[model samples]
Target chain A: MTDSAVMVEAKGLRKVFKGRRGDHTVAVDDLTLTCRAGEVFGLLGPNGAGKTTSLRMLSTVYRPTEGVATIDGHDVTSDPESVRKSIGFLSGNTGLYPRLTAREVLTYFGRLYGMDDGAIEARIAHLAQLLDMDFLEKRCDKMSTGMKQKVNIARTVIHDPAVLVLDEPTAGLDVLAARTIVDFVKDCRTRGKCVIFSTHIMHEVERLCDRLAVIHKGRMQFDGTLEQMRATHGHDLEDAFISVLEAA
Target chain B: MNARRVMVIAKKEFKDVLRDRRTLIFMVLLPLLVMPVMFLGIAKFAQEQQSKKQSRTLRVAVDSNVEPMITALADQWMAENSPRLMITSAKIGLSFPAAGGDRKGLGTMIEQVRDMMDGGADAASLADLDPDLVESGVRLAREIDPADKALFDDASTISTFRTKTEFILIEDLEPSETRLPAGVEVPDDLPESWDGEQLARAIQDKTIHAAIHLPSNVFDMLEDQRASVPFSVFYDESVSLSEEASDRLAAFARIVGNGLLEMRLADNGLAPQFAEPIVFEGADMATPSRRVQAFLGGLLPYMIIMFSFFGAFYPSLDLTAGEKERFTMETLLLAPVSRMELAAGKFVVVFVAAVVAAVLATTSLGLTFTQGILPQGVAAGFDIQFEPEAVMLTAVLLIPVSALFAAVLLGVALLARSFKEAQSYTAPLQFIVILPAMAAMLPDLEAELHLAWIPFLNVSMLMRELLKGNYLWDFFGITMLSMGLLTLLTIWGASLIFRRETVILRT
Candidate 1:
C-alpha cells in the first residue's frame, strides 16, 4: 500500500438478522478489512456471500449488529450521516426514478448531498461531459439500460464522495456496458479515490484490483494482494475461490 | 429533522404526482363533473318513470255482485258531472243553503255559478260565493279543450277520462264453468279452485295486476247496514301497476260512498257534517331547501371522508411501495436523510392530496344544490352555506382523518412489493372506512358521548350534525382528541416501518 491516508476500515463488522420465529442469521460475521486512498479493493464472492451486507453497513444503510465499519474515520453507526456523506454507494438493485429526467435525478441527489443549486447544475454538466452523455433531458424510463447505467454512475459520484462502494455494479451488463464500469473504477484510482468493488468475475479482479478479499458465509476467507492470493491458494483465482469455500 | 429538506422532498413528490393522470381524475375531474350529472340524471329519470306509470292501463277482477256499484261510479266519473275529488285534506263546509232539501234547486244554482265563472268571475272575486260551487265552476271554465276540462274535474283524470280500470266479473259459485277474463289473466298452472292464496300468487307474479274481492253480502250490507261495509282490496304493493290500480279502485269506492252519503243527508234533511268527523290535512310547513338540506346532510359527510381516503391512496402508494418497485428506494435511503424526514415528506404530500379531493367534492355538491340540479321550487329554501365554526370544525376533523389515511396508507403500502400488491393491501381499507363513515347515514344514529370516540364514525356524525346546524361541542372536543391521538399513533408506526431496513428492502 502507498503511504496515503486510510479511507475505509471495518473492524469486526457483524450483522445478525432476527427471524420472525425467534431464529437468528449471521448475515455478516466479524468481518474486518482496510483500504487506503488511491487503491481499488476487490471483494470477490458468489451469491449470498454477505458482499452486499458488508457494503450496506459501510455506507450506513444498515446498522451493524456488532462491531463497526468507518468511512474515512466516520463510524457507520454513531456518525451515520457523516459516513453516508463520505461514501458514494451503488449496487445492482439500485435504480433511478423512472419518471425523472437524468438531469432532474442528478439534481435531486446533489441537493440531498446539501449542494446549492448552482453547484448542483455545475456538477451535473461536468459529469455529463465526462460520461459522454447527450440525452440529459430524456426520461430515465425510456432510456436503454446502457444509458440508464451511465446516469446511475453520474448520480453515484455527484457529491464526489471520498469512498465508493459498488456491489456487483456490472452483474447484468453486457461486455460493452461492463467496460464503462471497469474504466470508471480505474478513473477513481487515478483521482486518489478509495473504491471497494464486489463481483464474482475473477478476470475482472485480476485485471483491476491492486488488493483483493474473498468472502463466503459472512466471513472473510482471504484478504491480500494478487500475488498473495495466488501464492496462498493457486495460480487460478476461480479454483482458489472454491478452495476457500471448501475450507470454510 | 430539517424542514427545508422535508419541503424539498415534498415539492418533488407533488410535481411527480401532478403529472399522473389517475391522480388528477380522482382529485379534480370526478368532483367537478360526476356528482351533478349523476344526481340530476337520477332525479329526471324518476320523474319520467312516475309519469309513465300514471298513464299505464290497469285491470281489476271484481266480483259480479259489487261490479254494478263500481261501474256506476266509473260512468259518473266519465260524465261531466264528476264530483269534486276532495283530497282527504280539503275542508268542505257541510251546511246547505236555503231550499236545502230540494235537489232541483241545488242543480239550478250550480248551473248559475257556472255561468258566472264563464263571465270572468275569478276565484278571488267570487270568494264570498260557496268555495265548493266556485271550485267546480273554475275547474270547468279554466280549460281550452273539453278533454282538458274533464281532466281538471278529477284525480289522475288523464287515465280516469280515458280507458282506466277494466273490471272483469267473476262468479264465486262455480270454478268448473269459468273462462279466464281477457282483462285479468290467470297463470296457466293456477289451481282449478279460486283459492285466495293462488290468486295472491298471481298478483305477486304480476300475472294479473289486481283481484278485487267484494264481500258476498256487500249488496245486503249497503242496503240495510247502519255502518259502512268493510270491503277487502287485494293488490300487491311492490308492483307499480298494483299501487296505481289500488289508488283508482279506492277513488271509485270514495265516489260511490260520498254519493250515497249526500243522498242520505238530503233524504233526512240533515247537514252533510253528520256523516263526517275529523279531517286530516297534511300541510308541509318545511321549506323545500330545508328538506333538501336534511336529505343531503347525512350523505355529504360520508362522501367527504371517502373522497379523502381515495385521494390519499395512490400518492401514498406511488411514493412508498411504488418507489421500492421502481428500485429507487435504496437510492433515496442512501442519502443522509433520516427515515422520519422521509415519512414526513410523503405524509404531507398525501395529506394535501386528500384535502384537495375532499374540497373539490364538497364544492361540487354545493354547486349541485345551488346551480339548478335541484329543481327551482325545491331549491328555493335550500341555503346550505357552512358557518365559519362548522367550516373550522370540519377542517379540524379532516386533519386527523387525513393524517390517519396518509400514515396508514404509507405503512401498509410500504410492505407491498409492487404497485399492484399495494393496491390489494389498500383496497380493503376502503371497506374498513366505509362502515364507520356510513354512520351518518344510519337514520337513528346520533352524536352521543360513546359514539364520539369511534374514529371514522365520530367524524362522520359530527360533520353531519354540523351541516344540519348542530354544534355538539363535547362530541367535537372528544372526537378531535380521539382522532388526533390515533393519527399520532399511526404516524409513529409509519415512521418506525420506514426505519426498518428489512421492511424497506423487503428482505
Candidate 2:
C-alpha cells in the first residue's frame, strides 16, 4: 500500500473561461493534487470554488488553461484520449441519454472505449451485477433518480477505468441514493482503483477520504491527510473545513 | 478520426433519437402522410367548386334598350347547336363549309350518303329528313371505308361542347326588383334608377351577375348583314360569378354571329375561307409523361428540399442542444472519441434522417400521383413515370443537400443552450432554406448557368432540370462542386464548434 503507484496527479492546473468580448473568468487559478492507486481523495470546497473545474481538467473534459494533469500516466492535454480511457468521470452535470436504456448507454461507452462486441457484452454483464441494475432494459427517462444514478455510474465505469473522478456525484441524491454512491466509492478503493470524490459535505469527507484538498476562489488552500487537516485547523471536520475557507 | 468510434457514436445516437416519438413523427409519419392528403384534398375541393359554379344559373339584367331580336337570335343559336339538331345534321351528311380536315373527302362522303339516303334527294332540304331516315343515314355512313372513319371523331366531341352556362335574362329593368329572376336577390336599398353607372354598381354589389347592352339598331344591322356589330357587357372581374356571366354572354354572341356569317357567305357563294384569312392548329408534341414531368419538375424539388431540411431540424437539435440541456453532453465528451468523430457521428444520423424523409416524401408523392389519388381529370393528366437515369441523378443531388442541412443545423443548434432555444435558432433556418429551395417553383425562373453556383438554389434548379430528363453536365458538375464544398465547410464548422469546451459544456 505504501508503494502504490500514483494513479492521478495535477500540478499548477488552471482553467480560464474566456468570454466573447475578450474578458476572461478564472474558474480554477492554481490547483495541485495527487492520488495513488487504492486511495480515496476528497476535494472539498464551497459552491463555485473550482472543484468541478479542476476535476474536469484532470478528467480531460475541459482543457487546462495552464497546467500538467495526468490520469494513469497519460497527460490530460497531450494524451486526452488515453487519459479519458483511463478515468471514469461523473458529476452533477454528467447525465445519461434519457431515451437510451441502461444497457444501451453502457454499451455505447464500451464501444467508444474501443472494446469489441464480445468484450462489451461481458463488461455490461459484469457491471450490471456489480451495480445491481436489474432495470437495464428500462429507459433512463423512465428510471427513478436512484436508478438513473446507478445507470450513470454503470456508464461511467463501463470500460472498468482505473481512476474514477466524481465531482459532487451525491450532490442532489436522496439519502439512499447517496449511500449507493458512498458504497461505490469505497468499493473502488477496495478494488485498488484510484477515486477522486468532490463534495462540500464534511461528513462524507470524514467517512471516505484518505487524503483531501480544500480549494477556495479557484486556488488551493489546503492539501493533507484527515489527521493533518484536523491537527492544523481543528478536530471537528466541519470546523476544519470552515477554518480552511476562512483562512483563505 | 476513428471510424469505429464515429460508428459507435452514430449508432447510439441513431438508437437514442429513433426512440424519440418527435423524431419519428418528423422523420417518417408527416412526410408520408402530408403529400397525399394535401394533394387529394385540394384537387377534390377545386373540382367541386368548379362544378358548382358551372351548374349555377347566373342572373343577367338586360336593359330595355336591348332589342327583342337579340333574344330571338340567341334562341335560334341554342336551337341550331342543340345536341339533337347537331346529331341529325351529322347523320344527314350535311357538313358545314367551315368544317376543316379533308374537306374534299368529306364532300365525296356526303355525296355518297345523300344518294344512300334517297334515290334523288334535294340536298338543300336534307335538314328536313325524318329521324328514322337520319338514323339509317348514320348506319350507312359508318359502312364507308375506315380511311373515311375520321369524320365521326368530330361527332363525339360535339356533345362534350354543350354550353355549361345557364343564363336567366331579365329584360324589364324599370321594375328591377320585381323583374329579377327567382332565387336572385338584390339589396332593397339599391339606387332608385338603374342609370349608366348604377348599372355597373349593381353588378359590383352582387345585385346582378352581369348587364348586357345591345345597340338599338342591332336587329336592323343584322338584317342588313353588317360586317361589324358592337355590344357592351359590364361585370366585375373580381367576382368569379360576375366574370363567368360576362364571358358566357360574349361566347354566346360570338357563336350566333359566326352562324350568321356562315349563312351570309353561303348566300354570296363564297367559301368560309374567304372570311377567315388565317387559321392555325397547334400540335402539342409532349407525351403524357413529359407533361407530368414538366409540372413535377418544378414542385418535387421544393418539397424534397424543404422536407429534407425539416427532417434534419428536429434530430440535429435533439442531438446537440438537447444533450446540453439534459446534461448528457458532458457524458458524451467523457468518451475517448474526438470532437470531430462526435460531430461526424451526429451528422451522419441527421443526414440519414434528412435523406430518408426526402426519399419517403418523394416516394409517397409519386405513389399518390400514380395511384390515382387525385381527381380523375387531374390524375389523368399526371400519370408520372420518371426515367431511371433522371431519378437516380436527382437522388444523388440529395446527398449533398442532406449533408448541407445536417451540418448547418448541427452547427447552429449546438450554439443554443436548450432545446427551445435551439428551436428558435433553427426554425428561422427554414425561411433561409425555403427561399432558395423554392426557386424551382417559379415558372419563369430559368436555370441560368450562373444559378448553378448558388448552393440550395443551384441544387433546386438542377434537380428540376434533371427530373425533366435534362442532364446538363456542366450545371451538374458546378452544383455538385458547390454543394460538396459547402457541406464540407459546414461540417468543418460543426466539428470546430464541437471542439469548443465552452459550447459543449454550456449550461
Candidate 3:
C-alpha cells in the first residue's frame, strides 16, 4: 500500500429538505472532513445526526444544497457522474432488487460502472470467492440477512471503486455479518482504497479507524486519530465518545 | 443520454419484472386470454337466447268473422306459393358449394354460379360464362326435387323464425284484469276503450302472447278499391314474445289484404302495375370484410389505449415506487448513470411493455375473429380485412400513445412511496382517460380535424379511421406529432422527479 493520499474531501457541505408548505428542515450542516487512500475513516454520530445525509452527498446520491464535496477530485455537484463513478456507496437506504439474483445484482452494478463483460465476470468471480458467497445464484429476497449483507458488500465493490462510503454498514447485523464488513474494510485499507464508514460501535472504530470524526447535530465536534482522541479524552473509547459529545 | 447505460438498466429491469408473478399476469396472461374468453362466452349466451326465442309458441285471438276470411285467403295463397316456397327454401342449401362436390361435373357449375353471385356480377356478365356451364348449374339446382330433398344435407339445422301461432276467438278472452302489476306504470295516453280491449287484456295477463282483431265487415266492403281497411292487432310491446307475435299477425293480414286487392283488380280489369308506381332496389357498396373492419376499428382503439395503459401500469409502479419501497432506488441512484439516463432506461422498458400488451391484446382479438372460434353466424359478421399497411400504420399510431402512457404512469407512480400506493394512484388514472379513449365508440362523432390534437381521443379516433382504411394523412400527422410532443413532455417530467432525492428516496 502507498502512503496516505486524500481521496475524499468535503467543505461546508449542507442539505436542507424543503417541506410542501414552505418549511425547511436542515439535515446536514456545514460538515467538513477528509478521507484518504490506504486508511479507514470512521464517522461517528447519534441517530438523526446527518451521517447518512453527509455520505449521500459525498456519493452524489443527493446534491448538496450548499457548499462543495468531492470524491476522487470530482465535485459532487459539478461532476456528479464522475464522483459517482469513483465511489461505491452503501446505506440502510441502499438495497438490492429482491427479484434479482446476487450475481445479477453484482453484474448490474458492474455494467452501470461501465465495466466490460469480461472484467465484470472476472471481478464478480474474485469477489464471490473473497466474500465467501457461495449462493450467488440465489435471489436477494430469498437470502438470509448475513447472506444478503454479503451480496450487498459484493455489489458495493463490484467495480473496485476508488472510495467506499458505507453508512452504518453493520447496523442490525449479527457478529458474522458484522465481521464480514470489518474484514472488508481491512482488505480495502491493505489494497490502498479509501473507506469512509459510519457506525455507533466504539470497538469497531477503535479497531479499524486510522482517522475519525464525530459529528453531532450536523457539526463536526472531533477530527483526529484514535491515539489523539485517547490522549485528549482518556483511554476508554466509550468515555472518549461521551467526551466528544459533551464537548460539542 | 447514455444509451448503453440506459439499455443495461432496461434489460435488467425487464429480467427483474418478468420474474414477478403480478407483472407476468397483467403483462402476458390477461392480454392473451381476456378477449377470446369474453367473446366466446357472450356469443354462446346470445345463441342460446336466440334459439329459445325461435322455438317459443305464440297464441293469437282472432275476431269471429275475420277467421274464415283469413283461412280461405291463406288456402288460396298457399296453393299458389307453397311449391315456390319449397324451391326457394331448398335454394338456401345451394350456398354451401361443398354439397355440390359429390356429383361429377356439378362442382364446376356450382363454382361458376357462386363466383358470379359473389362477384356481384349482373346478367350481362353472366353472358361471359359458357352457356352450357350456366345451363348445367340451373339444371343441377332443379334436379334436387323441392318436395323430397334439399341440396345441402344439413338444411334442417338452419335457424329460422319458426314461432307457432294458435288462433283463438277474440270473444272467448277473459274479462280485462284492469289492475296493473305492482310498481308498473302505464302511459297516460292510453285510450279509455278500443275494439280489441278484451283481447288486449288477455295479452297483458300472459294468457296469450298476442291478440289480433280484424274488421267484421261484409264482403261488400271490397267492392270499392279506395276503402281503407280497419284491421287492428293488439299486443303488449313491452313483452318480446307478444311484440313478435303481433308483427307476424300484422304481416299475415297484409298478405290477406293483398290477395283481396288482386281479386278486386282482376274484377275491375286493371293491371297490377297500377298498384305499384315506384320501387327502390338498394345495394350496399361496402364489402362484408370492410364492414367488419369499420365495426371492429371503432372498438380496437379503445382496447389498445386501455390495455396499453394497463400493461404499463404495474411495471411502472414496480419499477419506480416499488424500487423506493424496496430501498433499491437509492442504490440505483448511486450508480454512475445520470437521472435522465435512469428515467429513460425505465421508460423504455415500460414503453415496450405497453406496446407489447396492446399489440398482443389486439392481435389476439383479431385472431379470435379471423379463426372462426365464434358461432358461424357471429363469426361471419367478423370477416375482417386487415390490410398490412393499415395494421402497420395503426401500430405506428399506437407508439406515441404507449409512450405517453409509460411516461405518465412512471411519473405518477414515482411519487407514491409503495406498490399499493402506486396502484391507487394509477387506477384512477385509467378511469380518467377512459372517456377520451372511448371517443371512437360515439357513432355520430365525426373525425373532425380539431379533435386530432387531443391526446387519447385523437389516437382513438385516428386508429378507427385507419383500420377502416381511411388513411387521413393530415389527422395521422397531427395526432402523431401532438402525442409525441406530449410523451416527450411527460418523460421530461418523470426525469425531473427521478433527479429529486426526496422523491426517489421517499420512505
Candidate 4:
C-alpha cells in the first residue's frame, strides 16, 4: 500500500474521559496514525489502554475528546453518518440478538444499512459461505460461541463497508476458530479494505498486521513496521513489547 | 432516515422483547389473564362478606321495665320489617334493689347476674338470683340516683366510663351475645340529649344510622291528643347505602305514628281519614344507568390511567436504560437511522402496550357491569350499557393519552442508569395519574368547559357521561384536543432526550 492510498487518518487524536472523582483520565492522548487501503493495521494494548476508545472514535461510535479523525476523507465528528456508512465494526463483546436467527440478524442489519432485500439476501449468502457458517440456521443463543462470532462478523460486513474496525475480534475463540478470524482479516485486507484491529495477542499482530502501534497507558509507545520495530528494540516482538513497557 | 430501517429495528425489538419470558409474561399474558381472575376474586370476596354480614346475629341485653315496652315495639317493628331486622332480648340485672325488696339479697343477685353474663360466675350461683329479684333490681336501677349528679358532672369519669363500656362491647361480649336473629347491628351507645344539630353531625360522622328513642310515656302520648314525641336519627352522608336504610326506617316510623293517631281518633268514633288530610307520593328520578355510571365512571378511568403507566413501564425501561445496561445502545446509536426514528420506533411498542392494557381494563370493567359480577338487585336499577361507538371514541382519546404516557415514561426512564433505577423513578407516576383520574367520580362534578381541559379528569367525566348516554360534544372536543396537544409536547420532549447521546447511553 502506498501513502496515496491511505483511507483513514488520525492526527493528534486524543480522548480525555472525565472521571466521577473530579479528575480527568487520558484515554488516548495526542495520537497520530494513518491506515492505507489494502493494509491491516493492528493496535496492541493492555486493558484500559485507550485502544477500544480510539477505535470507537474512528468508527464514529464516540466523538474524540480532541484532535481530528477522518474516514474516506469524511470527518468522524462532523460527518458521522457518512463515516458510519463507510465503516463496518466488530467486537468480541458486541452481540447479535439471541432471539434472531443468523439470517434474520444479517437481514435486519442489512436493512438498517439501507440495503435492498435481494442485495441483503445475496450478501448474507456470500458472507455465510466466506465464514463457513452454512450449518448455523437457528437463533444465535443455540449456536456455539464460535458460530455466533462468525454470524457477528457476517453481520458487521453485510453492508460491504469500505473500512473495518474490529476490537479483539477473536478474543475468546479456540485455535481453529481464531484462525478463521485471522484468515478473514487477511482476506479483507487483500480486497483493499483498510482494517484497523485491536488485540493483545503478539502472534495475531505478528501474523496479520502490516504496520502497527503499541499503546501503553493511553500513549503510543511504538509506531513502525514489524522489522523496523524488531531491529530498533529487540529480536523477539514479545520481548520488545516488554522492553518498551519497562522503559516507559 | 429510511422507513425500512425503523421497521427493522422495531421488528428486532419485538422479537427480543417477546423472547424474554419475564417481559412476555408481564406485557401480554398478564393483562389477558389478570383481569378476569382479579375481578372474579373481588366479586367473590364481596359476595361472601355480604352473605356473612346478612347471616350474622346480634345479642342485646334489656332491662325488665324497658323490656315490656321494647319487646312489644321491637316485635311490631320486626313483624313490619321482615328479613331486614330481628330482635330478641336477654334479661339484664340492675345496679340497685327495688323498693320493698331485700337490699342485700338484690345486691348479691345483681353481682351474680353480672358475673354470669360475663361467664365468670358458676351456674349454681347464677341460678340462686331468682327471676323476680333480677326484675326488681332492673326496675330499681331505672330510677335515677340524685347522688350520681355530681359524678355525672365529672367529664373525666364520664369519658372513662364510656371508654370502658365501648371496650366491653368490643372485647368482652361473646360472638352470640347480641343475637338479633337477623344482622341488625344495634350501636353500642345511643345519644340521650337528642339535640338536632348534634344528631345531624353524628349522622354525618357515621355514628348511628338510626336511633330509636322511646319516650318515657310513649303509650300515654299515643292516648292523649296534644302530646308530641320526637325521635332523632344520625347517619353518614358518605355512606349512601346507610342513608337509604335510614330513610326506609324513618318512613316506617311515620307510618306507625300515623296508625297510632288513627287508632286514637277512631276510639272517639271519628273517621281515621279526619286525622290525616294530606298524602304525598315520592319518586327517585335516577335511572339504573346513571347510578351505575356514577360508580363505574370514576373507577374505570382511574384504573385505565394508572394501568397505562404499568403498561408502558417495562418497555420504556427495557428499550432505554436496559439497552444501555446491556451495552447494545452504542451499536444502536451507530445505526444510520436518526435518533428520532429510534425514539419513534420504541415509542410505538410502548404506546401499543399501553393502549392495549387500557382497552383491556375498560373492556373488563364493562363486562363486570354487564355480566352481573355484582349482586343482581344491588345495582339492578342502574342501566349501564357501553355503546361500541362511545367505547371506540374513548379508545381514540386514550391513544393520545397512552402516547403521552409512553413518551414521558421513556424520557424519564432513559435518564436512569439501570432498569431498577428507572422503576424507582417511574413507580410514583401511577399515583400521580390515579388521584386526578378519580376526580370524575365526585358526585357534584358537572361536565364544564374548564374541567374538560383538565388532564385525566376530563376523560373520566366524559366516560361517565358517555356511559349514561350523555354526549357532551364540547367537553369531548376540548378533552381530546388537550390530551392531543399534551401528547405532542411530550413526544417532542422524548425526541429531545433521544437526541442526547449522554442520556441515551447513560450507563
Better of 2 and 3 by TM-score: 2
lDDT of each candidate versus the true structure: 0.76, 0.78, 0.76, 0.69
- Return the candidate ranking by DockQ, descending: 2, 3, 1, 4
Judge the docking of candidate 4 as incorrect, acceptable, medium or high.
acceptable
Candidate 2 residue spans exceeding 4 A from truth: A1-3, B59-191, B194-207, B214-230, B259-274
Best by lDDT: 2
Mind giving the per-residue lDDT tens digits that candidate 1 earns over B1-507? 999889888988887788777878877787677778777777778777876665444455554454444333333332323333211101111111113333222223333444455677654444334334334433322321244354446623323321211100111111112221111212223333456887688778776677666665654676675757765678889887787767655654564566556656766897778877767889998776667767776888898899899889889989988898888898888988888888899899999999988888888988887877776644566675667888777888888898899999999999998888999999999999999999998868867789988999999999989877899999998999999999999989998999999889872
Best by TM-score: 1
What is the fraction of true interface contacts found in candidate 4? 0.46
> Which tens-of-lDDT digit does each residue in B1-507 have in candidate 2?
989888888888899889989999999998999999999899889888876665454666655555243444433433443222222223221222222333232233333333433565443234344323333333333442233345543433322111100001111111132332212212223344588788877778878787767777775787777547776787899998888777666654554455567667867999879999899989999988888888899899999999899799899999999999999999888889888899989999999999999999999999889887877887886776778999999999999999999999999999999999999988988988889998988879988889899989998998899888788999999999999999889888888888898887887
DockQ, all candidates in order: 0.66, 0.72, 0.69, 0.38
Per-residue lDDT over B1-507 for candidate 4, one digit per residue giving the tens place of the 0 to 100 score: 567667778777877776777666556666655666676777678887765644443222222344345444544433332211110112111112222434232233223334454775433342243322222222222222233334334423334333322332222223242432122234334533557677666555656544445566665664466777654444554765455445544554554455456446756888867865776878879776766666776667677776676677788888888887766677677667778888888888888878777766666666655676655655365456667777777777788778989999999998899889988988888787887788767868888889988888888788777755678999999999998888899898989988765577667
The predicted structure with the larger DockQ, 2 or 3, is: 2
Q: Candidate 3 lDDT, tens digit per residue, B305-324?
A: 98898789889999999999
Q: With candidate 2 superimposed using the best TM-score fit, by how many Å does residue B112's alpha carbon deviate from the native? A: 42
Spell out the clash pairs found in candidate 2: none
Candidate 3 residue pairs that clash: none
TM-score of 2: 0.82
**For model 2, what is the C-alpha lDDT against the true structure?**
0.78
lDDT value, candidate 4, whole model: 0.69
Per-candidate TM-score against the hidden true structure: 0.83, 0.82, 0.75, 0.72
| Highest DockQ model number | 2
- Candidate 1 colliding pairs: B289-B381, B289-B382
* Candidate 2: docking tier: medium
